[model samples]
Target: MKIRVLGSGHSGGTPMIGEGWGNADPKNPKNYRTRPSIVVENDKTRILVDTSPDLRVQLLAANIEHIDAVLYTHGHADHLNGIDDLRSVNRAMNEWIPAYTDAKTWSDIVNRFNYVLEPLKNDTNVFYKPCLKRNDITVGQQFEIGDFCIGVMDQDHGFMRTLGYRINQFAYSTDVVELPEESFKTLNGIDTWMVGALWEEPHITHAHVDKVINWAERVEPNRLILTHLSHRIDYETVSKRLPEFAELAYDGMILEL
Candidate 1:
């Protein structure tokens, strides 16, 4: 399996519109983040996780022309707002894509992009708007998406709950403040874990450095790649602070498992 970090920044991304890079160095390109998202692919399938607001740029940079499916972690704007960009993918494939998420996230997407969910009118072309087939998922359930046998668990995201997905030996868990015990069980024996660590300091809705390190110790993945970083966390500084087996994720980072 191959995992690509399409975007690694926090909700607002590094160097927020008005505010600029807080502690991250401007000279380091890795500090210039977009938003949180990833692509997991193998010989037979390519799955996108979260359609970040920077979806267009990220996909273009990654040169991804096709996607087998989309898995939504939650409904936060940073995660789901760029959903409209799926129209571009639809144009390329000339087919509606399948999207998997929990019931609440489906509701959120439906409420925000009802038009996209609507069947294409006879006069409308597939390229004119995003077309998606929704598949509702439940926590603790296991299902298959192409070549992947995925297991999902519930994560506490402060104001809401997010889904954490484990595909084979790799797992992606972002926008999480706390992981339920069952979630940890789902993550057990993973070889590589891509999880969120917002910054060095404690956060109300996201995981901090200490919390992430603690979880890493428990999960004991051979490789721990942290994502969803804020400008407050400097890549060089945090990289030095992490264990040898753990490191901060950057946009375009790829891992093969």
Candidate 2:
């Protein structure tokens, strides 16, 4: 199996336009972080996780031409705003992409993007529709969507809880403020853990660097890669201070596990 880090930056992404982190150097590639997303694939299937606001550029950067499924972590705009981009893939493949989301998340996406989810008449007048199918995903359940054995884990995002997933030995969880005991135990013996750490200091709604470190120590994953980074935590500084099992993830970083 292979896991590709498509984007690593938080919702606003890095080098926020005119946010004045003092003119990031054009040549410094570290400053070029996109919104968070990833691709998990094997020989038989390609599953996309969290199509962010920068999904278009991220997919092009990764040179991804086909995706069989999309597993959503939540309905946040940064993660789901790129819904329209799947049109090309659907048209070319002549198939509907399977999109799996929990009950709340699925409804939220459909409500927010009514035109995409609801059946509509196309120019052909033969019931032209978006070539994507949204399926309700259940938490704490193991289900087979295609070729992958997916284990759904629960995570808290402060206001509400969201579902994170495990495919093979790699578990991807992000924007997680609190992890319940059950989910924490499920992370045991994971080979690669891709998790979220928003910044250096404490956050009420997101995991800070210290909290992430403490959690990692407890989980003891063989390797950990931090994602969903904010502008406050520069790549250089975080890389230097991270624990041996943990490191910062950058766009286009591929981990073949």
Best by lDDT: 1
Which runs in model 2 stand beyond 4 Å of their true positions?
Answer: 20-27, 120-129
TM-score for candidate 1, please give it: 0.98
Each prediction's whole-model lDDT (CA): 0.94, 0.82
Structural similarity to truth (TM-score) of each candidate: 0.98, 0.93
lDDT of residue 207 for candidate 1: 93
lDDT of 2 by residue, 118-212 (tens): 54455342324445676887888888856788889999999888788988789998989999998987787888899998888788778888798
Among all windows of 10 consecutive residues in model 1, the one with the lowest summed lDDT is 118-127
lDDT of 1 by residue, 75-172 (tens): 99999999999999999999899999999999999899987778888866757889899899999999998889999989999999999999999999
